[model samples]
Target: MLCIEDLLTLELFKTLPRNRLDWICDRSQILNLSTDEILVSEGDPARGFFIMLSGRMGLTRRSDGMEMPIGQHEAPSFFGEIPILTGDPNPVTVRALTDCHLYQLSSEDFLTLLHECRNFEQVIFKTVAKRSRGLESFIRNREKMAALGTLAAGLAHELNNPAAALVRALRDITPALLELQRMNLVYGQHQVDAEHTAQWIKARDEGYETITHKRIDPMKLSDREDELLDWLEDYGVEDAWKLAGPLAEGGTAIATLEELTARWQDDQTKMGTMGLRWLALSFEVMSMISSGLRGAERIAELVQSMKSYSHLDQGARQLVDIHEGLEDTLRLFSYKIKNGVEIRRSYSPDIPKIWAYGSELNQVWTNLIDNAIDAMNEKGILEIVTTPYSDRIEVQITDSGSGIPQEIKSRIFEPFFTTKAVGKGSGLGLEVVRRIVEIRHQGSITVDSQPGKTQFTICLPIG
Candidate 1:
């Protein structure tokens, strides 16, 4: 049923000699496939070269038991050549999308033609090159999307705690302000003596300063709170425990409270009520202000870290502090490391900044540090050490995780080579690191691994 006229339509056969075309047609068998029929399953052994004669076929790749359509083969197109040439299992499943007619050439016959026909070999190799580039381009973009997704997830998690703290601080400060205003009106009405009122204001200001500038020891604070509670209760103050916490946090001494209460000793009701309430409320306002300030600072710090990691407001290539970049990445990934990972940094203060692609260089650090976290499973020590080498700055990132296997170490930097499970890795992370460090920055990266320690060392020129 097949004719040389059908072969003429294919660019591959059109360029081949008449005798060779006849030879290929004779050696190949025709296969008719109905819609939805599978021609070859992924991981199946290579059977032959398939040249599509009519209808369309689709190719789907399986990743983690999920099938994803990657490409298609229409009439006059050919496949199975890559697997045949490499002698590997098929990388994707091929199925007919419509009723299809295909010419299947046995592997032996295909190789014989490859060896004997110069034009045929050239055309096949060209197709291989073009197809390889297309696949790589598609996969590289997917790898970037995957990496961005991971970093976005980590960033969201890292931002949550501080953002929540900021919200809570803002919410609590409002009610405290209203309570302070009510206390101000009451103080004017009570009209205590000027001298004693000045003393109370002085004491309140001092307590505010202590809350703002001093750090309290937890154990000491606990002891002081108990003492204050006992004294307040003995003096007939109701809810004595309510005033203990802020007073203790403000580092208020028992003697100071006693002296402040001396004026109101005869008026026990006032001393136990207004005097105690005023002092506690003053300390509470100061504490809320401090908490709010700290929450805002933390939010700002995270935002600044993200900006630095991205090299915002800067050109692509610039003089970069490698240590700063590493720190920024660590800050961005703190959510992942803070719980169990201990990070130790050793830096050579004299090492100079390097001229390089700033953000891309940061990407190298991100990938290396992220990989280290994964290797340790978030529970080991990670060390970052920088020192001056011969006219270069050397950064060594070492992790206390199970080391890379000797056999696979050499291939770890190869694109599409991964130890991670399918769907978890696009396998381009280390390859991108390699390209950025070596090709883009003209730097060198090397790995040293053993049973419990694995180190990735990068040396960049001081330019």
Candidate 2:
């Protein structure tokens, strides 16, 4: 049974007059719970206000398909007010951590008392604000972590192909060089004729040019390989097919091979086909070096893009080039954007750098671009245009995809308001974007949407 002493144990109840305290005692119902028992679950309808007389309760919220502990409630505490006041479902689940006794007041009775006592209402609203801020803070951190995880995964995916190519090139180049060195030593033992050697060197240099410059037409390469194969076989070279493709890729003419090999044909040593073998191997080695260099360059490019996107070397606030930031983001998101999404850019080269929070401003871009990609279902044309003025710059990101409904357009920026399925969104992405733009940077962002086209326009002062 509820008593006056139990009511007085909480400072909040002490704010009420004696008659109101007696009224609470009469109206509140006694409830007992064992350890691990649930008091209320997340998303449950607002039942009433709860006053914990004894024991502790844990508060957890669901995020990304997992239950995360947000807070706890101890004995001599009160809760269940936020949902009741807002007339919304509970945002967290409260479960008893130990055997407990609690008093629950019906929603109507709690509201009646709330209106009757100004001091109590004041205290309740203040607590509500503090708790709301705490929850928001926790959620915002989780959102940042989730975003970071996504970028890291994309970076890894983008790095894989080039890294593998580099490894294969390094692995294959060593043996080819050793074989070429053996061929050169054997050829040095023969009678040295300056004119004949010059012919072979000239042929080698021309082939090197063809391979490095990719001068051979890919369509003609197969037919050329067949012609080389027929000549190599007639010239009695073993595994003639192996050398044919590289020889053809090097733009080797069958007539040139005949002229170069004419003297070696009469010789009865490995030198008979050694000159032809040397030319093909030389071309293959050059191709390998070119491929390896390109792969290394690609790796460097991706690393630099990620570093610039993060603004890791810069201070919190700095002069930022809008186009550079946008380009860096697109590079990082290339894995997502390349799957049938076409990007159209109309950047104003004259737009001046703006003094702003560099990393936070990038976050604004991240959220908006990420959302645009999702809205398009990863297959659409995304258009970005920048307009520069003397005092301000405007960026418009437009996507060809399903647009926001007219009725929900106004509430899209509200915190905790989202159209994404549960676990797919925290509902604070655009809200955070709004805060960074309007509140932090003193800029403004607006969205215009209709079926098949949605555009978000952001205006920021250049200072």
Pairs of residues at least 3 apart in sequence or in different chains that clash in candidate 2? none
Minimum summed lDDT over a 10-residue window in model 2 is located at 415-424
Among all candidates shown, the one with the greatest TM-score: 2
Residues 1-463, model 2: lDDT tens digits: 7899998998888888889999999999999999999999977889899999999999987788888898999999999999899886777889998988999999999999999899999989999999988988887888888778778888899999889888988999999999999998888888668898998889888888888775788779999999999999999999999899889988999999988877668788857588889899998888888888888999999999888888888898888999988988888889999988999999998999999888888888888899999999999999999999888999999999899999999989987677775557777899999999999999999999999999999999987
Query: Compared with the true structure, what per-residue lDDT tens digits does model 1 show for residues 1-463?
Result: 4678888888888778888888887877989999999999877789899888899999876553577788899998888888888765666689999999988899999999899988889999999888767766666666666656666787888777767777887888788789878877887887778988888788888888888987788898899999989988987788989998888887788788888888678783474367678889889878877877887888788788888888999998888988889998898888889899999999999888888888898889988999999999999999999999768999999999999999999989986677875556656789889999899988899999997899999989886
- Report the CA-based lDDT of candidate 2 relative to the real structure: 0.89
Q: What is the TM-score of each predicted model, taking all chains together? A: 0.89, 0.93
**Where is model 1 more than 4 Å wrong at Cα?**
1-4, 26-48, 55-71, 86-109, 266-272
